[model samples]
Target: MEKEHRAYKSHCLVLPYPSQGHINPLFQFSKLLDHKQIKVTLVTTRFTSKTMHRGSSGIELEAISDGYDEGGIDQAESIQAYIESFWKVGPETLAELLEKLSSSGCPVNCIVYDSVMPWALDVAKKFGIVGAAFFTQSCVVDSIYYHVNKGLLNLPLTDSEISLPGMPPLEPLDLPSFVYDFGSYPAFFEVVIGQFSTVDKADWVFCNTFYELEEQVVDWMAKFWPLRTIGPTIPSKYLDNQLDDDKDYGVDLFRSNNDACMKWLNEHPKNSVAYISFGSFAQLGLEEMEELAWGLRRSKSKFLWVVRESETAKVPKGFIEETAEKGLVVSWCCQLEVLAHEAVGCFITHCGWNSTLESLCLGVPLVAMPQWTDQSTNAKYIRDVWKIGVKAQPDEKGIVRREEVEHCISEIMEGERGKEIQKNAMKWKDLARKAVIQGGSSDKNIDEFIATLVKR
Candidate 1:
């Protein structure tokens, strides 16, 4: 008797929690799966799905697929509150997609879940699909995330010093944005953590950082969760496709540039350029913005500043004219490429997760200027954990001063401390490369993951 036939290729759905930081990594992991010849079903909120799949450069998640719906924040306490509450609809939305694909004779093999969302595991179990968790932060941060809810945040002592396993204990002032400030307005930390029900229950967990980048912390998390570190994913992929002959990747359609910035960098010496960006989500108050401008002007360092159109950015009038000759302000530039450029010596950043990882992988030290959300968490790691960056303080209105900014930049670039961070950053870079090589922990884990994902 003849047996029924199986599908042509294995397919896995990759879903990020729907933010630029989440979207970028999920796209990388999905592409990595495709590279291994597995078919992909990339999932996103309706809006992000449109943004991510808008290119011929990679696999696009089709809206025509069944169960596809417009993704929006739920009508909960707040959008941040909605992140956790949205899980109630996860099973339903996922079911629609599954039923649609099955009806079309294509059954999903497994799921690659974002570690932040635990509900993915439940949906995976319902369909007998393998649930894989893709962790977006470094393992150092991961260990903290896994434990912060377990009596850490509930510590009764005010301004208590907390010690992470690998580094020295930290004061409340040192704890970046996500942990302490979450009690304040519009905090996602409270909601997201409460709803982190799916990720810890997964069959396999994948991390975006390579093993060596967070070796000690990665090793520690392995006992609690089935962990795999597979990052420097963005830079790793970028290096693969860049051509020696091409001037730019031509992915510039997404970027808006103001080129006077590049011209300023051209005039500066190699490794002398200070590139300033507060990252995708970090914001500055009006006072902080002007102070930073004046600080950059006073530092005597040739600089490139990225002016993102965020709600918090308040640019003063006459500012452009005052600093135009020495400083270049641009909407955006090819960030990874710019960091990798020899002209970039120091980075002034808000320490978003991606920016921290990217700058670290490129061996560039940072002058951390974290604003809110996970920016503080990332800043803590960059400043306290990694010893590769310096932190800038926020004022009474929660804005840091211009003189302090100038002093901080000078301290990082020309003083004895700046030299130290540069040294440490290069050390991290060497290990990052080592981790991506064959037989390395990250390399082995990625190979094993793709094998299981495609074969099972």
Candidate 2:
């Protein structure tokens, strides 16, 4: 049912970069604000609004054009072209949205824009309202980008190791792929680095991480920006359950097979199945997929894997049917529900921030198979700092061979080391819950954000 419209002390327009990973956190944060009686309007591109599966969360939804009203990035000539077009068109549409809202007696008081699109803050400023930059990545990752943006970290890094403020020394392999490989996905590298362009001007900077989880980097960032940590932005049901109706993230770019996945998990024993997924965007080459498939077979452990429909053809012929008695493979499944299931032993993941946070929040150990971008860094933390998982090492060909994949899975799903990792995972899970529950670190930061909006 649609929620009743009611008067609120402040109206905040939440804009996320148009992607499943980017949209989910911002939407979850919007739900929290709505629960606090802050009027929240979530804005998506016309294309995304048309394609997304909208849940009945009832936060007001609005749409602005990203220039391709029919199809978003897929319609563009290139990533660079798409980004340039969106940059030019996004601000104009956003200003129009502001003008429309103002004339309707519901003027926006703030715009919490995805940091990737710094132009949104410019629109917020043009309308004379508070602008908050919301970063959907970890603080350590953001700090790396901020340094690169400021020229503190030089590209084509000459050193084997990097030492930065409030972060542990990192090997070149441990840095984000954009930084380590430089010029790979140039457009996306620009987007990540460009986030700092107008960030100093934003009234507040919010990161989707709890303070306790990233205390050092968060503290370092706070010194330079009005930074606040308010996340692990999954549904409240997975965290604190403070928002009664908060279950799934209210939007998804793809449909999931919840019933089939849950049924498969129900048939497995506790902590017996390895849950494998490469997230929405990462695509494994056919050879890698074959290796992963064979590795699952060789591990002899029951497993559940999510292979996006586009990538399903790459799966080895007859692999699914051959492994049918021991495994289930689907295009997509409700991730949180699968992670929360007692049968899911360890996650073999791409280590995307959203997936990492989900596994961490749900107390699932990991076998990190990092593909690119921030996944490597997250995997580093998963193995080193967090001690809740093991990172799979790839060979010189840059493929995690079946042997290594099988080894990592075994390491996490069996033996004394697995027990320690499971213990650490549960400890972080409790901390995650505490951070989002009443009077906790993330909850307090959110309260401060709302309080500031009301005062403004």
Candidate 3:
């Protein structure tokens, strides 16, 4: 009887939209479930499994076909083509994987799927299992998308300011790029808005944010959906240190020069280095890159910048050699480790949701240089709502000038405003830690999820 019970333990399969940012939070959440003695399997596409720099996540990994076994999204003709193919093929393979797991004696009882791929929940329903929608963005951003999906917020801004429940008035620019710059990337816009298509049917709606961070929005959304805030879903060491060996996200799609970056940071003075990265997918134009390069040079602050290998040429000619004494430019470094270092005083970022949350959780002030998508909205919060950073304003040409970049960096690093921003950053950091530690808001929510799953 004991053996049979152990063999039939409740299991959850976590499915993330195939990207580093999407995978990391879901994987961290899977680790949380695994730590609670729940059997967890992380689902990746066959292509991503082949491409990623696999790390020791200490959990089982399984692959499903995204209809592009050979090359994934890059092989697809366009974003729409890729999404359509995945939607058609994902359900069939997912059902097959479920059957395979069931015959293997570890039947999956639940699926925690990326909200963007809502069809996964339909598969879970077909299998008579619980389906949890895992949203990998801020509640405010999700709420905005939800509103747009429900036709509450019409497109092509005619209004000077927009009002939404549980959020302050937002300007046209403060809205997500998908909404503000309507039709810019219609396929991606569809993917974002389509998240709400079947979300009402999910057994649980999980947002990767803590209650303290977005209490008002979370509460408002909870009234309509079974919304739960269970995140900052970063590794435990940086926040509460509750989970053993939870230092890094444990999986990377890109390589990092860990030793070199750490060594350079170690040599810098405490709270002196400005750590700059634009996450993995953002691409800046050559002119913008040139301006940014010179801007960092003008700031006269010691900096460490992650310029992806593809963008290396865009860095102004001789800029690397000229700034070598004060700045270290590398392809990539372990961002969490760099942010946690005492030498990293401020972050100059593209304001991607994951990067924004990481900076907020780690107590690092920011200079928000938003690129696109949900970034503009996040940057708005970072500068106005959170009071932890200042946004670098772009000119009418939608290019942030070198002088503006220097000013934003200076404001965070040396100006009187820097002191206030630093204080707010530390305050959010403590709150973030408290949310994930034992008996805290996010911890309790995770416990509730596990308890409900076990009961089912």
Candidate 4:
């Protein structure tokens, strides 16, 4: 190793897809690297960078444009237009940013990028820095994508059940929404399918999941590439059972109402509250929103919901007022704190991977209401493979009715089924914690990965 490299001060430029789900894990991973005494810089799109709360002391933050930074690709006409605009501008912009960073004394030794942006690997290779693909989603989902790209699995799936080696059988509904309806989201479908083509070109690959949690898929992927399990990329405070001081990831795309939500949770009886959220991006139809409202009220469970302020218009006019005593609705809250709270018995979620892992790590059972993308696969794992949650099935019209929602809520929060799921959830929580502490599976993987990075 050269003198600078011999010092083990590897500087890594981390780039995450600009979405809230993608940014959080990469940012947390950056913090972990900084904690390990590596120089870290997290890069995001200009718009996402603006929304982040700058609190982490050791990490550097930077931004590159995705062309439509003012409001992001939401302003574009379609998914195709949005992504095309991103490709037209993102790669060149990122290349310039890396060059500037290198010339200004912080030469990057490696590039760790979210797999969604496969084009980043090319840019990193051009710069002669090692490229590592970081998956913000589950290893199972990534493996599924790999199969799809390899033409081993067909899309708009014809079978009621799709089987993959080492994973539970999946129904069409269990696959990502994009798989069934590619026409409506051609750009997103393309990006997801194309990610694997360049994934093998990278020096290393990381998943925000622990080996114990998805051992089958993690092992399956390692046979194909230099894949490593180095996560539950949540804060060490939650996963490692460290002190509460390390809780916040220090970046919030949405403003949080932490104090009010925490206070509401505190007043509930132990393990009595049903915490509901659909993550940052999923939007519900007005009919579906009204159904969920009535369902929560009918279940008569103490509930805390995080609905975006913009979506509140969909709720029945008198719904919030009628359930005032039983339910608290906020625009957003610190999800980790709420999930960690003693009163939270069940999480009614859209089954996003981050939410899935968080619920598992904190021992909160789930009411899976998967919406789109990888959420469906995540919901499948929660309800079937893990058995720590119940999947809320929708009707023929694709609406999860109020009665169905109520039934699921009751079963997961009050029935014998709830007790079983809760026990399983707690078991997984202990395993997740074990995988993150010193000498644990995830910790050891991260330690070895860092050692490898320094040597490179």
Please provide, for model 2 over 259-331, each residue's C-alpha lDDT reduced to its tens digit, 9 standing for 90 to 100.
9999889999999999999999999988999999999999968999999999999999999999999999999
- Candidate 2's TM-score reads 0.99
Question: By how many angstroms RMSD does model 2 differ from the true structure?
Answer: 1.0
Who wins the lDDT comparison?
A: 2
Model 1 lDDT, full chain set: 0.69
Error of 1 at 120 (Å): 2.1
Candidate 4 lDDT over residue span 1-456, tens digit each: 132343336889899888778888888888778777678888888877776676644467888988878887777787788788887788899899888888856589888998988888999999998899998888888888888899899876788888987788787777787876655577788998888878879999999999999998888889989888888888877878542357877787788879999888888888888999999999999888988888898886899998998888887898888899999999999899999999998999999999999999999999999998999899888988899999888989888999998899899878999999989999999999998889989889878878988887
Candidate 3 residue pairs in backbone clash: none
Model 1 residue runs over 4 Å out of place are 1-9, 51-53, 63-77, 80-85, 103-106, 152-159, 185-187, 237-254, 258-264, 311-313, 395-397
Q: How does each model score on lDDT?
A: 0.69, 0.93, 0.92, 0.86
| TM-scores for every predicted model | 0.86, 0.99, 0.98, 0.95
Instruction: Report the candidate with higher lDDT, 2 versus 3.
Output: 2
Query: Which segments of model 3 are wrong by more than 4 Å?
Result: 1-9
Candidate 1, residue 222: the lDDT equals 82
| Cα lDDT of model 1 by residue, 206-232, tens digit | 888876657777777787778878776
User: Worst 10-residue stretch by lDDT in candidate 2?
Assistant: 1-10
Model 1 weakest 10-residue run by lDDT: 242-251
Candidate 3: residue 231 lDDT (0-100)? 93
Off by over 4 Å in 2: none
Pairwise lDDT winner, candidates 1 and 4:
4
